[model samples]
Target chain A: MHPAPSVIVFTVLSGLGFGLLSFLGLGLPQVTGWEAFFYFALAFALAVGGLVASTFHLGNPQRALKAFTQWKTSWLSREAWLSSLALVAMGLYAFAAVFLDISAGLLGWLGAALSVATVVATSMIYAQLMTVPRWNHWLTPLHLLTLSLAGGAILAQQSAVALALLVVAGIVQILHWVLGDRRFEERGHTIESATGLGDIGAARLFEPPHTGTNYLLKEMVHVVGRKHAQKLRVIAFVFMIVLPIAVLILLPQGIVSAALAILCYLIGTFASRWLFFAEAEHVVGLYYGARSAQAVAG
Target chain B: MTQLPETSEKKLGLVIDLDTCVGCHACVTACKGWNTENYGAPLSDMDAYGSNPSGTFLNRVHSYEVEPRAGGCSQTVHFPKSCLHCDDAPCVTVCPTGASYKRQEDGIVLVEEDACIGCGLCAWACPYGARELDLAAGVMKKCTLCVDRIYNENLPEEDRIPACVRTCPAGARHFGDLGDPSSEVSMLVAERGGFDLMPEQGTQPTNKYLPPRPKDQLPDMDVLSPALEPVAGEPKGFLKWLDKALEAI
Candidate 1:
């Protein structure tokens, strides 16, 4: 699993954006007039900008419209549709709140539900991949959802709720890492099973198919050192959860403290998201004999 | 549609013989050559002939050393891999663009290049690493099983099979309707004890691989003792004279 920069940015920013939008839809902070306009603008920029950034990784962005057609089977398709619907519903809600000086009550609730669903859809894009054992877990969606809500609560200035959600997100993040570490081996994919040669003996890759790198090796066989990953995990936990909690609790309640907390949380979330993709071991690596017992154990 | 058909009319796939493959990569070459020119998009290479070359290949031959558990000797097995065209092809169902689909008619999974968004979800879904995103074409590529030539009536009847199967010098590759129990491939699988790769993955792969036969077995004979017998209990001509001369010296 290559920790593609574009995908990382998309998931992180969009998760935050949708989380913020969900809070806004519920009239958290209950901003009106210019304040409502400012919040909506910020939300739209983050959400739409993340969506645009996602297209950067696509080989053919021109044909991305076709991506919306396969929601019945594809999680990516569902994410696209859900995100678009969320944005549209939020846009209408924003227009009413900003211009008409009224809360489009039913529409705002619908938008909030869609916003959260969009984040779930995004998580499913990775969770549904059975080939990547680490991502194929019920905890994957739970981790993303918790992070989204926690980030949303912080942005909405719901300090008490944000503090609790942040604590839950931190616990879920640790649990995800602990369980995900064993998933590849637990899936029972090894060089022996991959090649169907365990009956003969222990199999090792004698010669690779090509001398040069291929797409599979480049994309799925990415190796992240265990020590480096461990350091990043601590950094992520501190910034995303601990620092935000400390800022909200210790510092006097002010816009400046909330801004600082948001900045710390975003940085931490980005680091964790990078690990999410980097640490994932796709089963295909077993065939290449790249994911050995030591690699899995790490 | 990205949704898989309930049942394919025919399970058309390859039966690879691990015993026979010499790791020549001839099938790989033939597949790349034929597919680039004939398929929806030409398979592309990035930084080719440079430091760090990479390309999209539908088929590749990997070699593995299997050490016998009984401790006789290690054997090198050449494993040629490509799309298994699984009955439960995960790649097909994961395609967001509906570009990837399995043909209900022939059971050959294919990527409709025009509709492809190049999101690469299909490639991620495949456990075999069967699908590769064509870097230049910006579309997914996989072993089509030579769909173009297999069904082309214009080609000579003998040349109708997949390019890999036809080009395999060792006859390691076989192509047929595995859905039909009476088919040559199905019978070959049954006779040779052919098995699927990663059966636990439960792809129910249409492709089958016949395991390699045991190697390095020898009869109970002291081969060196016969040579040590020294015909007629003496060294022959030159050897006999040399022995006498050496003894005198």
Candidate 2:
């Protein structure tokens, strides 16, 4: 089925951690205080946790050290190298901020680059998988940006500038989802054409590959109805992407509504990611007579 | 470092004819036999004789019923899937250790099983699902295209072919230098319009499958399957029980 949860947690948690660090990197002279130090510490914690969580998904966790050698051609290797580099940069920035005799300006830019590096590396992992049609999209990068924005906004009780960037990120995320969903919808026909006899209109299947169930039928061909998927998409829109934006917009006025929105976005995004994997159709599934039923109906 | 010449004899590849394949799984069996006998390890069958079982084979035949589109009969497409030994293999790139690598001279992708630690990322990275984990060996294994047989200089020149291609009864499998445009395999591709499995996903699979021929070439199965032969017209046959059992009742 899907990749393990430890990986999911690592990606999401590290996203948030890096977003917070990026804002702290801005280092506005007007804003001087414990808030910067506070956010910095928490962000570093999440980043470290994300790094640790990555190993759980590896079959041979020890061999992960060898990934650093292939940075010339492999994106996965680049991601590993970048993540470790970011980890080091963020630590240096933290030390410079709290205990060292260092200029605030230098500390700020370094933190910013590390934050950006972390998110970019995170996005590259899925984008590099040319085998997966769903993940290899322009929206993949946008998804990371939006998710990071959402994370940044959640931690934005202290800064107006960070809060503003979060709003922009939220809008971009929503647009990316809307556009990406349309692109994915058009794919049913391409998939139908690839497996069938190239006539998009006339393709029909009166039979399946086997009389009883098999792994391909179960794992690839889910009998989950389209109506259910649409409903879930709506839930993802409102709670995961939209609600957090609304909460941040209204947060200066109220407390309870803001708290509720934050809670909703977290749970909603987790479910959306799960659905992302669940609904993905591997072309190997097509060989086993799992045609796009939606394309046929349309 | 020792510098090396990059060019020599042409690297041979397989071109499978989709039109003639009967989907009999003969090549699969032939591959298992040759690999077990000659290769480093035999294809192990787990619980094969006892109960539910499985084993490895270099090639597998998959049969599909293709619906008529733009006025062709509902046809049967017997396409087989395997490793393409690509010029640029994603499976080679993502190997954490330097275990999986493409040959420097030829474009053959291979795994150093000794260095591999049994991670299934190579399987995940391959869009074609070409790689499979050798559960007993605690490492991954895949189609080597009978590398041991074809490359051995001691063998006679006529015997230098992949085992599966050598054993195919229908002559459906063609082996030759795909790099040469005038090669039989290359000309076959030019004549038949060989299609890549998933070009958009774009692993750039080297092996090409010619699209299935028209359904007219297929014999009428309704008449053929039922009319293979009659039970040798004799007394006290298994069919006599049908009449006696019904008469008694």
Candidate 3:
């Protein structure tokens, strides 16, 4: 819940990158030779760059190779495996299209599926956390997937498809916020339940464990002002969804429009992703006398 | 390797008495002292003696004021919290590096410092906030339940327990196998009605907490009214003599 800069960048950039990769794998633009090379280069830069950015937050980036071993139970591990597989598959497909001038039909489809799966796996890293009530919802994955596809469609120059997906993404975002706000109360965690003192009486924090802050307080207990969050939500919606849709409808389809659309979408997604972490209410904060997510949302 | 065993042979955990804890934080200090020296990584502090000091600690004590709903005096409950070492520990399964694992033998959840990638996903998965990321070491640190001391043959037999349990001044901390029905801890839990923290989370924590006893129950009385009541119809011995002398004057 720290709204860590590394994480925000990682999720937004990677989501967009993978979205574009999925489209390219499906031969959405159907370009060959140098034109195909340029698109592939852009996709790889975003995808690989985002992956590298993710490691920046790790305390021990040197040991990150060990992260691939626990894919059986860990979503983070699954994400590592999935992203690697997606990259390799997409790499082969890109090589065939750009250099060999071949479609590599089956490989392209496989790469596309893996690319989307990688994004889902990334989303699961947050969605699987029951500790954060705002993120532990079905809508979390749905929201991310919709945004990724919408961004992908724009990059692929599919204006009609992009417009529809953008509308859907906007709906999912609203639904995510509306339902996520109520999740903490529905989960029924409170200071009393947190301390097992509900049967006796109402409990309030009389004294903290220490005079200064500790790791838990720093990592899990983030406070975002409601007014500020609301403003950001509006900004995200207007730029990420409304503007992209408006541009595709009004401006002539060209490289200039696509660039403007991509830029606006990235800015909006970055803001939304920041809110994603900042607004998440981890149940651990209940022990420190933080109000539940429902109360904070109010 | 991150997958937990179906069942651990023993559920080793602590039973904390809320009634007896004086909020002294002695256990907290003792835990830090013992763990920093003995564990995989020394708990590091940044700006320890300077402004804005912060450090990694395995255990912490929090105090809360509980106002009974039945309308009695409020009570302060000193809560000493650390790793619960849950039977269904989310931390272990969430570890991407296979560093966080629960021992099948003793049910002690531990972090293998060597294997740790310091990704911190385990810390996020834990609802209790038990695991902490060591800033200097870039690895996770948690309550090992003094695994080093408890099993070390060098220590005295009486010292074969968690540092917090051994050092608790009020004897409020109890460490034992909670899995066995006949264990002292299980019996104590049965008698005192010990309860788990955040049962809704379904972590199924091995640790238990004994709720504080009820306070401030007494019958109403008027001490001043009894004192003001007339002892005699006229007066007592000293007052009678004074009244008679006054009448003569």
Candidate 4:
């Protein structure tokens, strides 16, 4: 749970891009001509760029193609397949709208549904992890969906819906943190239970497995300080929620202010996403003495 | 392709005795030595001879201090951890490619390095912290349970077990068909109350760990403890004389 930059960028940018495409596929804002072309092109570029960035995090990027074949069991594979379907459908829709000057109705609806499905699949990738108790909740998918919609609504310049959804997204974010905070302790597995030594007395780690950091320690045992996390939460709230709502309400309704709100929301989402990974406590960490009396407050 | 089989034919696994392990780390070293040579990528080391040395290891021994209970002395428990090869392995299900899988024939979990994208999701899904992503090879690595050694017809029958089990100095490691009720390991489990590491996780791990028996009830504790009964006036006069004579001699 290192919160690698590639993943943060992938989720944020792709979420925004797909959000925009979803709205456009539904024929929102009633725009046409070069302006429509520009919007479609920008959305495509963002989605594709975010996806391309994802491969940089992989050790064997060349073998990523094989990931598409295991859809029966792997959510990652399902994401790959659904995203491909969404991209292809959106591409055809874009071509018809810009070049042929005719966006077919069936293709438009199919593209929109696929776009939404792609985002859902992406969310499922993290939500399905039972090892990370904080993420193993139904609210994870809701958080992803609402945030994407809020971002999407802002991009489409639908002032009323964006403002309303932004407020909802903020509340959902706070609720998610509150619930996730309690998940670790609610899970009964502790060092005593993990080692099956509770029948005896207290169990304390006398020696770690190694002197230096290994792969498991580096990847799974990420710990964030409570004070720092609180500060980051405040920052995320101000940018993701307060600033966007303020700008949309106080500032004039136009492209410039809307763009600023979107930027702030994106930054806020990035911070929250970072916390998502940083705060997750993998059950394996119990073996490494990660649990303490106050572990729940983390 | 990453979906698990409905059932494995032979649930071959290790039954480790926590009481006997001395934290010698012989199994750790032997596993690294055998695996790096035989069937998988080299257990690569980074900055090995430098200020901070780190490396990939399939098995690791963790020592814990357990507080005394029931008038017993505090004990050091050497816990050797690796892949449990669970029946419901999340690692296999989470693999995007078919690289990470549990063998249907023998219940051995393996990583097919050739097909691996090295995304490291399998490592994240495993609660036992068994899998390690090899930085140099750009693929995930784990305890194969020494599949090559265990199944190799070339090796002597006595040596046909995992390298860790073979190298344990205390003879604490037992490997056999856990599926068979009559197997030695199953009987040991039944007798000693062998348990999984984290039963709540619901991984249904094939491996079982025999808990260290309570020290207070140990049959030899009375013999080991010092006793103070004077030999001079034990039974009678003749015995006393004999005891004194023996002591003087």
Give interface RMSD (Å), model 3: 0.7
Which model, 1 or 4, shows the larger DockQ? 1
* Predictions in order: chain A TM-score: 0.97, 0.76, 0.97, 0.95
Per-candidate TM-scores read: 0.95, 0.76, 0.97, 0.93
Question: lDDT tens string, model 1, A174-233?
Answer: 999999999887888889988999988999989889888888987988885655998999
Global lDDT scores for all candidate models: 0.91, 0.63, 0.91, 0.87
CA error at residue A231 for candidate 4, angstroms? 0.6
Q: Count backbone overlaps in model 4.
A: 0
Angstrom error at residue A127, model 4: 1.0
Chain B TM-score against the true chain B, candidate 1: 0.91
In model 3, what is the error at residue B33, expressed in angstroms? 0.5
Instruction: Give the TM-score comparing model 2 with the true structure, all chains together.
Output: 0.76
| Candidate 3 chain A: 10-residue stretch with minimal lDDT | A289-298
Task: Kindly report the TM-score of the first chain in candidate 3.
Answer: 0.97
Per-residue lDDT, model 2, residue A132, is: 51
Interface RMSD for each predicted structure:
0.8, 5.4, 0.7, 1.1
Docking class of 4: medium
Error of 2 at A215 (Å): 8.3
Error of 2 at A65 (Å): 1.0
Report the C-alpha lDDT of model 3 over B1-249, residue by residue, as the tens digit. 789999997999999999999988889889989988987999999789998999999999999999999997898999999999999999999899999999999999999999998888889999888989999999999999999989999999999999999999899999999999899999999999999999998999999999899985877787588899877789869999999999999
Tell me the TM-score of candidate 4's A chain: 0.95
Candidate 4's residue-wise lDDT over A159-223, tens digit each? 89899988898888998899998987887778987888777777988888898989888788876
**lDDT by residue for model 3 (A1-298), tens:** 8988999988888888899899998889887799999888988888889999999999889999999999999999999999999999999999999999998888988999999999999999899998998899889998999999899889888898889999999999999988998999999989998999999989988888888988888888878554589899999999999899888989999888888898899989998998899889889888888783436544
lDDT of 2 by residue, B93-118 (tens): 76656667766555566776666665
Of 2 and 4, the candidate ahead on lDDT is: 4
